[model samples]
Target chain A: MSQKQEPRRKPGRPKAGTDQPDARDAILDQAEFCFAAAGFAGASLRDIATRAGVNQALLRYYFGSKQDLFDAVFRRRGGMISGRRHVLLDRALAEAEPTVETLVRAYLRPQWEMKQSGPGGAAFIALQARVHAEPEAHALDLRREVYDPSLKRYIDALSGLLPAIPRDLVATRMAFLVGAYLFMLNDLGRLADLSEGQIREIPPDDMLEQLVRFLSAGLLAPAI
Target chain B: MSQKQEPRRKPGRPKAGTDQPDARDAILDQAEFCFAAAGFAGASLRDIATRAGVNQALLRYYFGSKQDLFDAVFRRRGGMISGRRHVLLDRALAEAEPTVETLVRAYLRPQWEMKQSGPGGAAFIALQARVHAEPEAHALDLRREVYDPSLKRYIDALSGLLPAIPRDLVATRMAFLVGAYLFMLNDLGRLADLSEGQIREIPPDDMLEQLVRFLSAGLLAPAI
Candidate 1:
C-alpha cells in the first residue's frame, strides 16, 4: 500500500515540501478504510492521517475538514463507479433490442466489478453502504451530486421498458433496487448466517446474474 | 417522549431508589434515538444518560455495559418485529391457497407497520439499518438472536413454494428481499431526490403493495 521510497524520506511518505498527488491518494485510501470501518462521526481524522503516514497538517492542506475529507473519499470512487455505469448503460441502450435484463445487467455490472476490483474497491463498497445509512444532512448532498444522475437514467430506461407501470412506481422500485444492491454489496455476513453455511460464497458472475434476473422480474411485475 | 410525572422526581426521571422498568424503558428509548442519529461508536453514553434523565450509573445498572444497552435496544424491537412476522407467516401458511404475494406481504407487513407505529418505531427502523451497516462483531450476535429464526422460516417457506429453485438460491433472494425492505424503510431520502417530486410521499398502503409486488416477483424469478 506504500508508494516508492524516496532518498532522505521514509517509505509511505510523499515529498515533504509540496502537495503531491500520491499523498492525496494515500489519504483518501486510508480515509475510505476508516470510514468503512467506523462511520463518518466515528471515524477519526487523526487516525486516518496516521494510517496514511502523513501528518494532520498535510491532511488539512489536502482536505479542509473531516467532512471535506469524507466527501473526497466518496467522490473519488463514486465518480468512477457512476462513470462506468454510464458507459455500460450507453452500450446496453445501443444494443439492437435492449431487454430489461440487459439494462439491469448494465446498471449492476459496474458496482459488481468495483467490488471485485481490489481491497480499495471493497473498502469503497463498505463506505458507500455506510453512506446510505448515514443521516440525511451528511449524505444527501454527496449522493445527489454523485449518484442521482446515473440513477435517474436507469429509472428512465426501466420506465420506458415497462410502460404498464406508473413512472412513480418505477421510481420507487428503482429505490428498492438500489437498496437491494447496496445491502448485497456488503451484506456484513448476514447471508452466511441466514443461510447457516448452506450457501457460503457465491461466485461473482453467478451473484450478478442472480441479481439481474431477480430485479428484471421485479421491474416487469404487473403494476398494481 | 417522556414518562408520567412523579412526586419529588423530575419529569424525565424514574423512581430513583429502585430499578424501575420505566427507567429501563426510558434508557432504551434515548439510546435508540442517539444510536440512530450517531451510530454505536459515535453515540455517547453520557448524552444517552442525560437525555433519559438518569445518570450513567443507572444505565450501567440496568444494562451493564454500552454494548449491553445497544443489544437491549435492538432486542426490544427486534423480538417484536420477528414475532409479528411469525404470526403473519403462520396465518399465511394456514390459508387454503396462499400465493407468493401473500407470503411476501406477510413478511413485509410487520416491518411496514412497525415503521408507522410511532417515533420509536421510526427510530428502530433507522437503528436496524445502521445495525446492518455496523461492523460484524458488533451486530452479528444480536441479529442472530433476534432475527435469524424468522428469516430462516421465511426462506424455508419460499423454497417450498418455489420447489424448482435451489434452496440456497431462495435464501440468497431472501437476503435480497431484506436489503430492499431495509433500504426502502428509511431510504435516507433517496427516493424523494430521485423522483424529483413526481412522487412525494407514497401512501403507506400503496408503498407496501408496491413492495409486495416487486419482491414477490423477485423471489419467484427462475433460478439461474
Candidate 2:
C-alpha cells in the first residue's frame, strides 16, 4: 500500500512542500465531517474523497485505509484537547492549594473552549458523543488509543486533591463528571427545549462555573 | 396512509384478542434491536420485518411507516419510564421532607431497573443514547414527544425540594444529572476499561447508590 514506488504519483507537484501537508489536512477535515455525520460504519471513503476534492488514489496514499483515516482524525483533535488539559492542570497545580474546584475547572474548561474553536472543534465534540454509542469494539479501541491515558492523568489529579476519599470512589466521581460533561455538551439544545429556553440563556462561562461547582461537590460528597 | 380498508389484513386472526397485540410487540422488539445497532438512518423496515419473522406487509399494516414505527418504539418505553417516575415521585412527595437524595433516586433508579427488565429495556436505553447523537430534527421530535414533559415534572420536584436554589439553576443541575446518568449507563464497560477494572467491581445497586449520592450533591450544590 506504500506509494513510494507507485507510478500513479503525480510529478512536479511541488515535491514535499506546503501543499502536500495541506492536502493531508484537507482529507482529515472532510473525514472528520463524514465520520461525525455518519459514524465509522456509515461513512464512505469514496464520498469523503469526493467531498475533499481529491482523488481516491491520493486519499488512500495519504491515510492508508479508512480505519487509519478515522484514527488520524480522532488523534488530530484528541491530541490538541489532551495538550490543553495538561497546560490547565499545570496552572492548577501551581496554585497554593489546588482545590477540587480548580482541578474540575482544569478538566472541564478546555472542552468548553473547544466549542469556540470553530466548526472542526464542534464536529469533533459531536463525533465523540457519537463514538460513545458506537459498538463495543470501536468504543474500546478509542478508549485504549485516545482516552485512557489522558483520563488517568486527570483522575490522578482529582484524587490528589481529595486524599481522604477512597481511590476507587474518586475514580467513580471522575467518571461521573466526564459522563455529565459529554452528555451535556451534546444535549445542550435538548436541555433548552426541555427547560423553556432557560438553559440556553446561561452563557458558556457561567455554565462552566455551574458545572465545576456541581462536579466539585459530587467529588467531595461523603462516602455512601 | 390509513390501513382501515386494506386487503393486506389477515383474516381469522382473533380480533381484539391476545394474538393481535403480540404481533405489534414482536415488531417493536425487532425494531429496537435494529435501531439501536444501526441507528435510525441505518436501520431499514425490511430488515426489521425479517428479524421479527413477519411479512413486510404485516409490518406496515401494524406500524404505518418507518418514522411512525420509530416513534412507536420510543413512546412504548418512554411512556412506561415516565409512568414509573410519576409513581416514584408521588411516593417521595408523601414523605414529610423529601430529601434531594430521594428525588434524585426517584428520577434515576427506575432507568437502572429497566436495564434488567429484558432485552427490550436494554435496547431502549441504548437507543436513547444514540438518539442524543441523532440529527437535530429527530432529537427535537423525541424531546417534544417523550422527554420534555416528564423531565419538567421531575425538575419541578427537585426545585421544590431545594427551594433556595434558583429555579433556572435547578433546571441546569437536573440537566447535568440526566446527562451523567445516560452517559454512565451507556459507557459502563468503557468506564471499567478506563479505571483498570476498578469500576467493574461495583455492583449495580452500589453503583446506583453512588450515582444518587453524586447527583444529589450536584443538585444541592450552592448556586454559583
Candidate 3:
C-alpha cells in the first residue's frame, strides 16, 4: 500500500488527529460493521468511534456526523450502482430473448460477485440486511441518494426481457428477489458451513432455473 | 361465566394471584411486542414490563433474563402447525406436478395465515421476521426446543408433491421462499386490506394462482 497521506486535522497542541488507523477508513469500517450487526438506529457514533479506536470527538471532525458518515460509507468504493454498467448492460441486452433461468442469473450474479473478497464488502452486505429489517432506516434513502436511477435502468432492462408478466407484478417480484439476494449474500455463507467461494459454484444457471419456475407459476393470474 | 367457586382477588384490593390480566401473559405479550420492535438483544425486560404495566421485578420472577424472555416469545405460540396430513400423501408428487402456482401458495400462505388472529398475531408475525434476520439467535436452541417434527412432515408432503425437483433443491427453494415470505410480510400489509369476511372472497385457490403465476415462472430451474 502506498504511504498514507495525512488527512488535515483540526489545529491542536497534540497536532490532534487520528492516533490509530486512518481515521476516515477506520470510521467507515467501524460504522459498516456496527450497522451490519446492530443496525443503524441500534448503533451510534460513539459505538463506531470506540470500535475504530479513536477519540469519540474526532469522529465528528472526520465524518461530520453519523448520518453523513453513513452516506460516505454508502458511497464508498463501488458500493452504489452508479457507474459503468455498459458491459453488464450489453450482456443482459444481448440475451434479451433469454430464458427465465438465464434472465434471473443475469440479474443476480452481479450483486453476488460484488459480495466477494473485500474488507467492507461483507459488512456492507450486512448493513444492507440491517436496512431491510429497519427499511425506514436507509434502504429507500440510500437508493434515492445514490443510484436508484441505475437500479431502475436495470429493472427496466429486465422487464423488457420479461414481457409476459404484468409490469407491477414483475416490480413486486423483483423487489422480493432482490430481498432474497441481499439476505443470502449477508449471511448464507457464514450461517451455513459454506465459504463465499464455495457457494459461488452453485451455478447461477441452476438458480436461474428455480427463479423462473417460481415466477412463471407464482404470479400467473388466477387461471389455474 | 361461572364466578370462581373460591373468592378471587377482590375487585378493590385485587388478588395478587391472577388478576385482570395475569402477570405471565402480560409479560409474554409485552415481550413479544418489544422483541418484535427492538429485536432479541436490543430490547430490555424493563421496557417489556413497563409496556405490560407490570413491575420489572416480576419479569425476572417470570422469565429469569432477557435471553430467556427471547426464547419464551418464540416458543409462546407453540403448536401453530400441529402436524402434517398423513393422507396428503397420494397426490401427484413432483415440484412440477403441483404446478408452480400451487406449490408457491402452499409454501407461502401457511406463514401468512397460519397463526391465530388474536392480539399477538401481528407481534408473532414480527417475531418470525426477527428469527429470519438473526437465525443464530434461535437456531440450535429453537431447533432443540421448538421445531415441530410436523415441519418435516410438511416438507415431506411437499417432497412427495414435487418429485421431479431434487430434495436439496426443494429445500433451498423453500428456504428462499421462507425468506421471501418474511421479508414481504415485514414490508407489505400484515394482512391484506380485505377484511376477514371479505378475504373469503379471495380463496386459497386464487391466492395460490397469483403466487404461482409470478414466482413459478420467475424462479424455475433453468432449462438446459
Question: By TM-score, who's the top model here?
Answer: 1
Ordered from best to worst lDDT, the candidate numbers read 1, 2, 3
Clashing pairs in 1: none
Q: Report how far off residue A121 is in candidate 3 (Å).
A: 0.9
Question: Candidate 1: which stretches are off by over 4 Å?
Answer: A1-21, A188-190, B1-21, B188-190
Give the Å shift of residue A96 in candidate 2.
2.7
Off by over 4 Å in 3: A1-21, A41-47, A64-79, A82-87, A94-103, A135-148, A190-224, B1-19, B78-104, B114-119, B135-151, B189-209, B216-224
lDDT of 3 by residue, A64-159 (tens): 877777777777733443453435666766863655445555555555555664756766766666555653435556655454455556556656
Rank by DockQ (best first): 1, 2, 3
Residue B40 Cα positional deviation in candidate 2, in Å, after optimal superposition:
2.4
At residue B120, give the lDDT of candidate 1.
Answer: 93
- iRMSD per model? 1.5, 1.7, 5.9
DockQ of each model vs. true complex: 0.64, 0.49, 0.24
The lDDT, on a scale of 0 to 1, for candidate 1 is 0.85
Task: List, residue by residue over B1-224, the lDDT tens digit for candidate 1.
Answer: 68866654444644558666586789999999999988888899999998998778889989998988999999999999999999999999999988888988999888888888999999999999988877667686787788889999988888889999887888889888988999998883457667755655677678878988999999988876
Each model's lDDT comes to 0.85, 0.80, 0.57
Q: Looking at model 1 chain B, report the run of 10 residues with the lowest lDDT sum.
A: B7-16
Q: B1-224, model 3: which lDDT tens digit per residue?
A: 77758543333535667545676888898888887776766688778878887678778887887777777778766445222222222232433456544645554554556433655776777666666555354434473345335334445555555667655555445556655656666655322321211222334344434444555544454422
Candidate 3, residue B167: the lDDT equals 53
